[model samples]
Target: MRRNHLIALATLGSAALLLGAWGFQYLGYAPCKMCLWQRWPHGAAVLFGVAAMAAPVAILTLAGALAAATTGAIGVYHTGVERGWWEGPSSCSSGDITGMSTDDLFNQIMAAPLVRCDEVAWQLLGLSMASWNALISFALVAIWLAAYRKSAP
Candidate 1:
């Protein structure tokens, strides 16, 4: 395939993922802090894909791959957090309230993030959205890399 077509396909993959996220949000599935974090790289990848299409630069293609990898990593981390493999950031992870003073507890509650990252809001066939994102983003990374390789001499 031509470099432009490859770039377009990679770009469309990110665009489709973004649209799916929005569709889930519209369906009342609120994204947690980590969920939101995973999205930024996909957004960057989509932009990079566009730029790569325009310039056909190897650097831009690699940048898109990097962005895809970033999101994939984040999604993996989120999956770990959701599965209790490790504690997520304090902002998004639930904590022990047992030893806290009443005031401290109240303050923690007030300052807690609107959505907890450790919980899976939705799942399919036992895989959460984050899991799906990781799988798809990794695929995007491969496609971006293929485009880069094909673009090279």
Candidate 2:
């Protein structure tokens, strides 16, 4: 595909991501801390996409690729945490409160988010949303990288 098409796709991806977040919120699915972490790179990708369209340079495309890859990597890590392959942060992950005082427990519970990073709140075709996000963002990274390579002089 052409460079312009790649840029357009990246822009569309950002819009899609934003829409999905909104949909989830509307559906009463509040994002956990880690879920919120995944939004930064998407924002960067969208900005890079605009830059790619305006300048169409290798550096901008590379930035876009990096942004997408960063988010994809985060998604992969989050997927691992969800699958219990590795541990997530205690703040987002569940822990024992057997010894804590009532006040402490209450404070912890109140501060804790509704969504747990280790829990698979939603899934599709046996894959969690993070896995799907990783796959899609990785593809977007490839597209951005390809656009950069094609633009090389």
- C-alpha lDDT values of all predictions: 0.91, 0.85
Q: Candidate 2 at 121: error in angstroms?
A: 1.3
Best by TM-score: 1
Predicted candidate 1 versus true structure: per-residue lDDT over 52-112, tens digit per residue: 8778679999999999999999999999999999989989889667788999988998999
Candidate 2 lDDT tens digits, 1-153 = 898897788767865875786688689888877777888889889998898899868899889989889988999999999999998887998766778999999999898877899998889999987888888889988888888887878
Off by over 4 Å in 1: none
Model 2 stretches astray by more than 4 angstroms: 96-107
Assess candidate 1 and give its lDDT.
0.91
Number of the top lDDT candidate: 1
- Each candidate structure's TM-score, on Cα atoms with residue i matched to residue i, is 0.94, 0.89
Candidate 1: the clashing residue pairs are none
